[model samples]
Target: MTFRPISIFLSPNTEKDDVQLASKLLFKPWLWKKGKEILKFEEKFKKYLGARYAFSFNSGRSSLIAILEAMDIKKGDEVLLQGFTCNAAVNPILAKEAKPIFVDVDETINMNPEDLKTKITKNSKIVMIQHTFGWPAKIEEIKKITQESGLYLIEDCAHSLGAKYLPSQISKKLRRAKKLCGTFSDAAFFSFGRDKIISCVYGGMAVTNNKKIGENLKEFQKKMNYPSNFWIIQQLLHPVLMNYLILPFYNFLKLGRIFLALFLNLRLLSKSVVRIENRGELPSYFPQKLPNALTLLALNQFKKIERFNQHRQDIAKLYKENLEKRFILPFAREDKNREPIFMRYPLLVDDSDKILTKFKRRGIYLDDAWRKSPIVPPATDLKKIGYIQGSCCEAEKIAKHILNLPTHINISPNQAQKIIKLLLNAQ
Candidate 1:
């Protein structure tokens, strides 16, 4: 049984053009670390989202660290965040010597505003909301809660780039004004990791509309050094290496898998989640500036942002319109105001691991978008990461049942239909 692997990330997210760009940049060693590409990307990204200021970072987690530092988060200050998220989101709080208050998530796989209200304390200074899997959380309700409590709102827009939130009730002047997820909060951060809305191998940006906060964020950015040229080359080599060395032989006698392991072992390919991050510890390289090389790849992806998002939306619509009635869908298509740019269409199944195995055998790869834990990489110790068992019951349950289907730009309508048929049969 030989066929091309429909990977969740490796090949599906890598375009021919992306590989070409990386290949060209690999030879231009002078442009590898410092250049105007960084400034250009930041300018274009801020303008795209209507933000006043934007600062780039080494990763999404790095961006969060800068946000926390800029806001003066210190020992004992509580940062409220929901469960069913990556430790990448939580570790930044710990890095600042602040306490992380875990809030439960509603069906949107985002923070439950009701549960959020219960967790606020006098020490709680910030409320961080994750737009999980490109679905906007109940931002309007949460915004009101944060405002009444006098807590800063930070939107984790790692999974959501073009996703929007349309409120049901609005003033006549602002009626029907659907807002992008990152803009509604005091500050927001975006990821350009391999599996995100856009891929630059690894990168992030922190943006704010507030004059003072933006200035503070810039100061923090100025203090950090650019990533080493060696690190920059490693990131640039990712897509190029994957396309040529690994993806082609991935399923052929498991040769691709072997090549991938070999590269990772030889230190040529980088792992998205590093060893220290899973332990709720910050890496030495964090909070650094986003190098110029990766921005070339990111800026290229930015050009196709609309096309990428629309493709995901269309695939999500197809899934919503066709999946079996028994399957629990992520969003209500009937709510015209509640638009979700589905990074991956999530379904709650009886046994996620079992279903994933069946799909993998058929050359379709599926897995839980966030790992099967309150904090991702499931190996993370709950006590070490400030989560207790049964803390967020809904998120814990969802972690066991969540199965993500690919909705990236590479998936075709026909392929989606076939995937739907496979899912129905698997049931």
Candidate 2:
């Protein structure tokens, strides 16, 4: 077999048309914002989620910032989120000057509603429920908890675009109709980063069904400015440069690795999380409007949402059927109506390091990239991010043993079989 790298960010969603468009738009960076593409993308996204309103931003963190601002999240107020997450999720709460109370996750790799109940206090204003790796959280139970506590609930759909949850008979208190992830909360935000279900290199969307929150979101969006032309150029160049300069040379003498580091160091490409964000400081440009150029790419991928998600579901099934009894796949089973997009298939193994090293040696680059710790970017200081170690024992234990396998559209069934076979052999 010819060796090829299988990684989510290695041009997984960037197709020929996307690259062609990005290349063409590179020279027209001056026309990057306030274009018809932005409005069209938002309208289509709203329709997709059956939401009353949608607003675009430069990143999912920016979208969350908009949601928090619109909700009037103020100083000393508490924002509760589960422990297994990224700084992208936590930094936004910090940006709003709110306290982030870490909640432990369950076997689903999502918020434990019981833990959520224990964490609530009079100061709590919102609960940010994440569909980690596209596994739907115990939303029905969690929603009921938030309702009883009178706390606003926001769905962090950054990892779960196109996923659905059908309420079970026991959850009849919730509307029994099937609901999309973003629709269940007061407001939800999605990421279109390079590795998300869809890619615009860097983009996000915020959606709300609440009329008052919708109006607030609209007003907040109006106050935000589009990113600068130079910044727009940086995003526009991402796919084109990576496809041309990075991936092709990546395994050849490690040239791609060197170029990636050089580009990030020289600021030719933007790091998904800036150094300061991991340090819990929000950058000035973190809360800007999504540029029209990037919105165009988002629209391109958004059109193929079903195709992308269907492929992911299929790959997840392969893992479920083939890797059974060999490894612990925590997020594999769901109720009939709950259709998860499965951005990455979560597996709990005895030694995460050993399995990851074995996969890497065989040309499969899957790793616990996002949730390496209770908070991500692994180097992030938990204290600075307000995570008290040992407070989330379940999350801390899962962090040490979790492995994520790629299930993006780029991985064909044949490639998925290879991954599954290798995983079984590893055990």
Clash list (residue pairs), candidate 1: 249-256, 250-256
In the range 1-427, model 2's lDDT, one tens digit per residue, is: 3324777557678777898999999878566887888889999998888889999999999999999998999999999999989988999899888999999999988999999989999999999999998888888899999899999999999999988898665365775667789988999999999889899988999999998899999999999998888788888888888888887777777788788889877888877777787789988888999988999999989888999999898998998998867888887665776778899888888887887788777656775466568788688889999999998999998888888888887788998888887878887
- Whole-model Cα lDDT per candidate? 0.87, 0.87
Estimate the lDDT of model 2: 0.87
Give the best candidate by TM-score.
Answer: 1
RMSD of 2: 2.1
- The sequence of per-residue lDDT tens digits that candidate 1 reaches over residues 127-166 is 9999899989889899999999999999999999999888
Where does model 1 exceed 4 Å of error? 1-3, 168-174
Q: What is the lDDT of residue 43 in candidate 2?
A: 92
